[model samples]
Target: MTAFHTDDPQPKPFRVADRLREAREAAGQQQKALAALLAWDPAKLSKTESGTRTAITEADVRAWADATGMSDEDRDETLEILAHFKVNEKSWRDRMRHGRRSVQLQYNELYRKSVRFRIFQTVWVPGILQTPGYARQVFTDLNELDPDTPRDVEADIRTRMARRDHLYDSNKSFEVILTEAVIRTLLVEPPTMLAQLVRLEDLLDLPNVRLGIIPQGRRVRTAPQSSFVMYDDLAIVEGFVIDNPYQGAQAERFAALMERFWADAVEGPEARQLLRQAITDLPK
Candidate 1:
């Protein structure tokens, strides 16, 4: 028996990965032998199995399905696992490669598949409603000091702009809450920040999108800093490091958090009025 370490505290994906590994072992193949069959480095197989690294290409999943002689039903189940794996892979790539520019696209795809989405943002605007220039400025500010700077800047901007299409699309329901500070923060120049504020106003009109702003002066009762999103179909909580696309408990906690925030959210004419006031206060 080969021993492996996993960082997952919940153990759902790790169990699924273990099942796939067991199937290979049942067929009397070693990790090296299986990697050779899939044309992947043996270490890649080990890292994936160990949950240290997760980036499964669709091709890799299909190969595993075929190699393991998975039934039609099982293959579909395996593909779901692959989808989760791929999402995590893309996330890690975005963080590490710094050139990868599709986090918003990936989030949108997940949103489309999700019946409900709950999001919280503390700094700057949420990606779904950010104007292109504002997004560029935000990404530029965040990444400028890094060596990867200019090359990654444009790609990140494009990716964020592309994600905005989901705001207008009616297929999925989105619930988003932003801290009042996000509105006041000047990630971009004055003109661009004004554009972003206007964009948020436009987004509030969308039937499918629910916008909430937590006043900077408002009382804070619960958790104070981190932001997260919860998808309905699957309970996944995405963070800066790991994407747990299948954690049921974490999903429930965030869903409850969303409800708490939404209940406390100021909406309708009053909300719009507050937004207007925030825009007026923007530095000229």
Candidate 2:
């Protein structure tokens, strides 16, 4: 949600199109000539260069690099940029062609396989922590956003609620941090939010979970960027226009920075107290 993001279709600098344009120009090939060289339609190359193509595939990048005789170093660098920019311009809904239930099953597998999870949520409750009522509303709202996609909120809710099964495993851990605004957000109905808060209170007794709640009024230095889940070393970041995964140094950095939020967080009894207060303050 930083200033670098834009909803408009206009491509950003140093992205795929700019890099492709630079390489093609350096190789003395115009759009039509390059398209013929790569056996691609001229319009495909044009749309790619104009940033109108919704997706720039890996094959497209590699073919362009190979055709232009790009240096290995420059090709690698451009590939990295391609990787980052691909997901940078789209919402999470773009991936839901099959529907939310499909993704939920995929996540259920991930949750089952991973032994440790470190989560930082800035908005609604984390998926594993959501109750049936809360999850239903969440799926409904998101599904409504994409009318073209096949809608099945009940199936999505069932699949999502099933993900909670792994929570009881003593070998696995769920280290989660939530901002005060999570429970405060009226993304769902009053009763549903109230139920979610009550569920948070119960999670306090869970031996494997270490719940931390960052009070809204708490002073902090750098702002937390996005909601992210670290399934071991991998960081899956959720942003306004991004639903991307990071690994290696990038993922490590996300995990390290999460410590700051944990440091500012109030846990144990304090977290329970906040949840109860939110419940008490709820619309009755």
Candidate 3:
């Protein structure tokens, strides 16, 4: 593993813990005294400050701020530090309350801001490359399985279609890797799937895009559990309940591993041939 360098070398666990200890000491409150005032076990406070806790909630930080007599300005800053721990993981159900279109719009913003993107998928077509017809079916199928998926499937599809324009932006570059199984999966009818495959071929002609396909029945070294997108330094992974973003070392490690996964795949004309073959296999 290469050493991933950042301007700051300290890990997140230590950063959060040290900040809490500093806040308490600066407020002239002992651990036990603060714990008593907050009605929390001393051990819980110890674990949090010692960086032993598995997870820390936003409420925990707010309560600590109040107990420490943190000023309004200091409280806001403390909460911002707390946000580092949870900013990466956002619940899809929570995001979809307004509707899936809102989530798609968020993606559009992310897409527009990123200069480079590394996308890997084990199932379904890549979102930015999907045709409107195919994107609608993909959203519809996801809605069937996830009751929380918003009802605005058509509007969501339109938003997704708008995202495709980014593929032509010369200032940006996209490297996409897909397992052969993605081609084998039938999310829509044969005709729609065929159109998507054709779209993939058209996208290949774009100067900024590089797409690769890992052949079926071929032994490969890399095993990816889920689809993820690495936009610059951040790795956005799809979780069962939420989207998990990794930062610093964690993001660097995944980004390196994805490069290895991309290497095991076929690209250029061979990848195009695989797509054509998959299209041919579809029902007439």
Q: Comparing candidate 1 with candidate 2, which one achieves the higher TM-score?
A: 2
Q: What is the model-wide C-alpha lDDT for candidate 1?
A: 0.66
Which portions of model 2 miss their true places by more than 4 Å? 1-95, 240-242
Winner by lDDT between candidate 3 and candidate 2: 2
Q: By how many angstroms RMSD does model 2 differ from the true structure? A: 8.8
Q: Quick one: ranking by lDDT, best first?
A: 2, 3, 1
Tens-digit per-residue lDDT, 50-156, candidate 3: 87773787788888888887777877776776665454323333556677777677678888888889999888787898988888888877777667555888788
Which tens-of-lDDT digit does each residue in 16-124 have in candidate 1?
5776777787778888888888788889888766755545555666787687666767667777776665565454545455443544455656655666677788775
**RMSD, every candidate, angstroms:** 11.9, 8.8, 9.8
lDDT of each: 0.66, 0.80, 0.78
Give lDDT tens digits, candidate 2, residues 1-284: 11112322222323778888889999998888898999989998898887767578888889899999888888888888877665544544454656777667766777877888999999979999999999888777776655666888898998999888788899999999998899888888899888898888989999999999989886975486689998877677774323566778988999887888888899998999899989888888
lDDT at position 168, candidate 3: 84
Q: What is the TM-score of each candidate against the true structure?
A: 0.61, 0.70, 0.67
* Candidates 1 and 2 compared by lDDT, better number: 2
lDDT computed for candidate 2: 0.80
Pairs that collide, model 2:
none
